[model samples]
Target: MITINEAYVDSLALNAAAVKNGRDLVKKNKITKRCRTEDKTLLFGDCQGSGKEPYRCSVDYLKPESPVYRCTCPSRQFPCKHILGLLYASAAGQTFSVEAIPQEIAEKRDKADKREEKKKEAIGVGSDEAAVPKRKTNKAALAKKINAQLEGVELLDKLIRQLVQNGVAGIDSKVLKMMDDQAKQLGNFYVPGLQNELRELILLIKENKDSESLYTEAMDQLTYLHALLRKSRDYLTSRKQNPELAMDSESGLEESIGHAWQLSELRDYGRVQAHVELAQLAFRSNLYAARSEYVDEGLWMDLSSGSLYVTRHYRPVKAAKYMKEEDSVFDIVKASELFIYPGELNPRVRWDDGPLRSMQAEDLERIHSYSRSSFTEVIKLVKNQLKNPLSDKHPVVLLRYSEIVVGEDDSYGLLDAQGKQIVLQDTAYLAHATTHLLPLLTPELAANQAMLVLFEHELSSGRLIAQPLSLVTKREIIRFIY
Candidate 1:
């Protein structure tokens, strides 16, 4: 009777195997004799099991974000397959006849409601006198925690200053030991992001030892790390002075420096729930602490808001079963609404809910309009981001490149209508781009025509290097990340 607006079934399963098994059970008509509501606040069903008496499965959807599941089954897995099947069946639009709340279900709902009421009461919702003291206590505790974190930030600042003064060459012999010490210190301070950065720096140094551009790469990372430390310290100081200001703005620098926000906090602080289309998704592998780590980097475009969002999923490389297949990145996922996390110029988001759908012509047009920018505009944007010092990887659209030039040493450069050029940092990226863009050009077209491109770029030492996302000609768009 109740319309199911959202389904948390997929997210609730313990593992991928459980999800598949649960969905399989539902498809085989295993769940039968159910009761549901129009709001889908409650769902109970009988799922035929191996025994004669069916398993009684119930889901209390009173809290849509975190549904409570209960099933009379012997499965060790939480919720088990029956619970998943029931929820899946509801999400699939299978109608259930409205029925009176059974005695057992009614008791459980009443208990839940009472507990929530008590929680509100304990927070002094019914009495203003108790609320003031509770607020003060919470504020004091938060202040203490922030002050402790500030001490850690101060330590990090000192280490960064030393690194800058000594230079990469000075630390080359002891780089591994230095990184290990710094990472351990960062871990002590609960700065996981900085720790990860240190690990990445070590990996770069080790892998690129024989490369000609090793110094450039090392200095780039060191400078970025120094800037990050400075920004984090400044922000923490400001946050300490005005706690209210911290609540109002997104902690971009803080997050970049290893502060993490919970999913609940993100949901509450999100700016919008909008539909997004996937533009590019790739799996990048790297070494950390002598082990391989994998990260799924997904670039998504918000159709309504016209903003780009980055979604990342990280796992140990050894967990092959849990990792996404590289080729499967191109598979069409249904269009769904996402909770857009807060950011000033660029936002990050995660999937909220929706059915899978194919990208349409109108969707493409909207995305292009939102993302397209002239080369001059791109430069201006990068300049603005560079002002922050700690900001990295700003996505931009470069429109109408008059020429794609192959520079000395096989480097790639693109010239815009204004005669301004932006070069790519990687020679391989240039080779790949030339292969694709060259085929689309004829002798006359190569001489006179221009093409549009989308790229995520970084500013290093006053130079802008493009990391190509897509190359768009009059007839087709070829994505580089995929």
Candidate 2:
């Protein structure tokens, strides 16, 4: 039988409620007919439910590292309460009879295997190792789309200018309604990105809670939207002339304008880096209310180049239950093929699933060396990136600190040996898990070690602040946020 513990079952829960419901099922003795294959590759059982018949569920561990939890329950959750109940039963050492796989499941598995083989053949990943051909861009179709996108860009710019000239006092419900309608129409113009931003701008205008704050954010959003329009128009115009142009590696304006990039295209455009080793410094999940999606963002450092990179996994809210949530990883990811998306100040990256192992002692030494010592240089670099309207304002950097300074405002800030200090505060977007955890560290260790922080420009304070993420010593890096 597959070895399992209650703690392991607990760790698999996506939410406290799910775990609680599962344990409740266990207590009620809802599970029955527990069985497993002779090899113990599959653990399956039926659990009594609200319906007349019990819900059939299985935990397929054919590939133990990537187990598949399946249940006939109507719940959208990947591992439904029934599946969890089964796992919890196994963890609780319930009696399970060894039996042959069900005929229906066996048939389903065979069909799935055939489908997998066909997919591998299509992707050129089969035993024969055939090379899949890259699809060429349809120039005529792409050029026509570019023209439409350019028209959308112009329409958006005109709307923005009208809004600016009319002033905030004139923005009533009718005006908001018109702007909202216009944003929806922009979707038909092949400018989903602009449409999203316009909606956000409209929302900012609608909320006048803090007038000063509203003015700051509204202006910032409007400024970025305006820049996006100009750059998008220029980009689409260029593509209109030659649709097969190279991907923009600099500003990533093509993608910024809502042009979806294929991984094959990015790779062919010289965005793939080989033999890249990345260590996850910190990870956070952000719910983008505007997009109605949850984005899992991980800050990673390139072990060889020591450059900061980001990995983003977006899970839409509607399909959140079906999709797996990307959690914090503690291993060193050694990817043979890494695809980097185009953008500034920590561009998003994706890599082929490959070797992952625990961090070694040498990994710590390399990470320590990557810590930037000069606050002056860090400030200059961050300022340059922030100047770009379309750039990510929250740039993450690792800083070597000498002391943790407590400001008169009762805020935490990091100070270097030469007395250059950067204040630390939790921003609205980047929530520091908890600043209270700072007191646990020894003052001497805190002074001598390096720290990873996310820099944000605080609108209310009118000052820049760094949100501390990880504290790094020579031996190991301790993370405060995920």
- Compare the candidates by lDDT and give the number of the best one: 2
Candidate 2's residue-wise lDDT over 1-482, tens digit each?
Answer: 34688777776877778889898898999997799999999999899999999999999877565677888989887688888889899889889999998887788778878997876555444323232234577888887787788888888899899988997667789988899889888988888778778877886787676777777788778889888888787777777777667557656676667767766566545667778999999888888766678989889999998888998888999987666678888889988778888888788888855467789989988998889988988999998988888888899999998898776777788887788998877776674455677778886766868999888888777788888888888788788877
Question: For residues 118-182, could you state the per-residue lDDT of candidate 1 as single tens digits?
Answer: 86565544453531333323656667766767777677667667777887666665766876676
lDDT of each prediction vs. the true structure?
0.61, 0.81
lDDT of 1 at 153: 68
Q: Which regions of candidate 2 are displaced past 4 Å?
A: 1-3, 48-54, 100-133, 259-265, 270-277, 317-326, 331-337, 351-356, 407-412, 417-419, 431-440, 458-463
Global fold similarity of model 1 (TM-score): 0.63
Among residues 3 or more apart in sequence or in different chains, the pairs in candidate 1 whose N, CA or C atoms overlap within 3 Å are 1-38, 2-37, 2-38, 3-38, 334-356, 334-357, 335-357
Estimate the Cα RMSD of every predicted model relative to the unseen true structure: 7.4, 3.7
